[model samples]
Target: MAEFSVTLLIDASTSMTVTADTPEDAAELAMDEAGNPSLCHYCSGKMDVGDVYAARVYDGDKEVLDTDWTAQQLAAAEKQVEKLEKRVAELEQAEQDAVKVPRGLLECYLNGGGDWVEAGHKLRALLGGGE
Candidate 1:
């Protein structure tokens, strides 16, 4: 068994906000069937992995509050939504820029042998796994 290191570059920033959602639908669409919804290596966030809902949506969009304030007659709700979309994109890019994952360091541990299993076993032991 080879030695491995785990390093996490978690953001301790106060401006960061995270949210999770669970979609009721899992039915594969035509694009999904054809692999159109591809997993983007660079675009992926920390919340990407275990999400039943779309993580990219949250990463790229701002939260619209439930309020009585209405969209103007000229700009419309669609325009507001569009503005939110743009904000989300900017935020997602900034988030990616702020945190850098050492993919090579990860590859060393993952591609090297038995590291994942060993780590899991150790965690299980800490959580009361018996001999």
Candidate 2:
């Protein structure tokens, strides 16, 4: 990431009346009046801004920056996030439909005092193999 400075150019219209003997003095007074102003009855204090907007950006090396760089990064990031979210949904669905057949058969034979031969027959039937 780099640093940026943004400057906005606007237009402000104003008028001032000054009492001076010479035109040069009046010009000087008008220039000075630009910085210091009072709200007048006829003047609206709001600044007028046009539709056009522009920004000049430069890095530390005085190099010009590519404006589309951030947009490209955002598009790539969105694609990656979509792929990961799809894979996560697939894993969650598989977990919900999974059956622990081997563990269940082992527990039935060893813990329930059921015979292994009978358990094998049942396992075959449960797996859709012919008994």
Candidate 3:
């Protein structure tokens, strides 16, 4: 059996310290402590024993537990990022295509031709709005 220091956090402003042989024992102690009616330090309502959540455990200055996301979670996050990036790239391509003027319209605009009114309308439609 190893000595464990547990920090029991009931809410944002309430916490207590207790020592136990193991983290599990510490958690149990915390639950028991929270069940006590007098130990309700922050809330006016009755403290539910289920609300006694263990925030962290440590052995001296070193933390002995892992509370981070698992490898599967990290992999899923990476896949989501990839999917979002691909969607962004597709949207960027669509925006580029939308802004692209037809070669004939470009030539007509540059040449100052008689079909300027029709070319301007085509340009406005391609750009999604009129200037």
TM-score of each: 0.22, 0.37, 0.34
Q: Scored by Cα lDDT, where does model 2 land? A: 0.59
**Model 2 alpha-carbon miss at residue 63, Å:** 29
Clashes in each model (backbone N, CA, C under 3 Å)?
1, 0, 0
Segments of candidate 2 deviating more than 4 angstroms? 1-67, 96-99, 103-113
Q: Pick the winner on lDDT between candidates 1 and 2.
A: 2
Indicate which candidate wins on lDDT.
3
Q: RMSD of model 1, in Å?
A: 29.5
Candidate 2 lDDT for residue 50: 43
**Candidate 3 deviant stretches above 4 angstroms:** 1-69, 102-107, 112-114, 120-131
lDDT of 3 at 66: 29
lDDT of 2 by residue, 1-131 (tens): 99998655654444446666654565456556565444455543543334312221233345232224565577789999999999999999887656467776786578546799878777667778857
Per-residue lDDT, model 3, residue 22, is: 84
TM-score preference between candidates 1 and 3, better one: 3
The models' CA-based lDDT, in order, is 0.43, 0.59, 0.63
